[model samples]
Target: MNVKMNGFISLVLGIGLLHTASAATHSLKYFYTAVSGDIDYPEFTAVGLVDNGQFMYFDSSTKTAVPKTEWMKREGADYWDSQTQGLIGEHQTFKVNIQTLKDRFNQSKSTGVHVVQRMYGCEWDDDSGATEGFDQYGYDGEDFIAFDLKTTKWIAPAPQAVITKLKWDSNTANNEHRKNYYTQECIDWLKKYMDYGKSTLMRTVRPSVSLFQKTSSSPVTCHATGFYPSDVMVSWQKDGQDHHEDVEYGETLPNDDGTFQKSIHLTMTPEDRKNNKYQCVVQVKGIKDDFIRVLPDQDATNVVPIIGGVVALLLVVVAVVVCVVIWKKRSKKGFVPTSTSDTDSDNSGRAAPQI
Candidate 1:
């Protein structure tokens, strides 16, 4: 009976040890929140170590006596190191003590895990080729980091020095003032970063569209008002297709409210007046797309006054022409009788022998 009991006890211990080893190998190594402007640390507990890897502690930050192994294992070092060289350095190593790392994990309890396999030194650019003295760190492609209860190993974040957003504004009365608006190029660059997982969000103010009249004789002019100018794309579309190379765009204006505004002018021609349909599409980064149409009704209304004035002027001109024609006819009849009288009088005098 004693021998049997000993064998059962050994088997149970072996199973327990194997389970612990498995748990430790896949633990979470980091925790963080990407949101800024709040408290520095998370409100929950996290754990990490060189030997056991990294894992999350499910208990709240306020709780004591939480089991470390029971915390979720989300990421390992291998995943983090492969995505970016932002954290790699020749002298970089996991120099932080395990106890210190644990204390940091518990102190800044976050709702998610951010595990990094390696950290490296980097320089900060403040211009002038000068760098801040603080040692910067990033993850090599081999490092793994994550947050929350996610099971997949996460790629380490990119360098913190990247620009996240750009703002543009224009003060010109109507986008009539031609200038190169860098807003689109800026957005394209930001998108590149977003595609690479470097930025979390892109934000900006709405952009404005304006229409101006370029023809002196044409009184049909329209203006687009009340658009915010930050982080927006202004484009002109004619007849449902994009008018790319032919159309000219204006400078992106900055508004006092930290937004952006811009305008464009198309010279109204007989052909344009005839077709009479145009559209301006504004695409704001991270916001819904907006489109404003210049319908036939709107265009007709704008041209109505000009048409009325032209019609009135034409009537006056025709009335003057008619009056001139009538006067010329009457003058011709009156002058013909006078000339006939003179001719008759002269002939009678000649024939009456000097009477």
Candidate 2:
């Protein structure tokens, strides 16, 4: 279906652990998250571990990652906003605990290096009407400690230092008591968003199409602009058949107003331009029909202006030749006789011509 369901509505319905060594240098480890929704609906959440304001990793809802590379996991960040920063905590006690752990790893108690940890939590109603919670635990070094948030208090069973510092607090107790209520609220919100998604309530403006010759030697381009939801397909067709070879696709980019634009090009030759049989077809997700644009006929192109220019130039040349010929003939008739004998007149009034 090529459905591009960005998590905006999916969150209304729904929604790991590691340790590190001690003695690591003081590096920034940020446990950041953004969560929205209430008790009755699902809460959409994005949790990540960032280092120095740059992303290191994130929990993928689809278990898939973009740029699909070796160090990157399968993760989708479509629901996250790049401009918005999540909350941060100083974690004074956690820092002290990590320093103690580092000391244990080092035979010599080193005080210069420190290990940092960060954690995030979110809850939402699942599609099956069940309340679910998600947590992310992150650390700066390879030998850091892990924190579990499923229970009311954060727990790290290792290195008595971490356990002692992360004792259960009154706030955590209060959150634990309201957990059920929060889950139900998320479920309610999920229902509302689902209805909104299914309702015929949103505006559906058709995409605008434009064509261009990218360069004198390059392909012909078809651009579709101002579409929504970022799900669209643009392709070229030759004589009613889809043309896949010699086609190039551009990434869909967001507009200031949140709409999207994309372009596709067909490698067209001078002969292909003359045929006038190529078509650009655009299909939007959730829309049943396709928008198509056809190539202009050769006669309707700039060739007409070029031909008219040639004809005008020929007319100017012919006019100049005619004027020059007439001037030469007139000059000959007005020529004066060079010899006195040629101009001498006898009893007749007419002048005699020279040999």
Top lDDT prediction, candidate number: 2
Flag regions of model 2 displaced more than 4 Å.
1-201, 302-355
Candidate 2, which ten residues in sequence have the lowest lDDT sum?
A: 322-331
Q: Candidate 1 clash total? A: 40
TM-score of 2: 0.36
Give the per-residue lDDT digits (tens) of candidate 1, residues 208-266. Answer: 44444434434332333334322345666678876554455543332323233444544
lDDT of 2 at 72: 22
In model 1, which regions exceed 4 Å deviation? 1-210, 214-229, 295-299, 303-355
Quote each prediction's TM-score: 0.26, 0.36
lDDT (Cα, tens digit) per residue for candidate 2, span 11-30: 10011022111111111122
Q: Best TM-score goes to which candidate?
A: 2
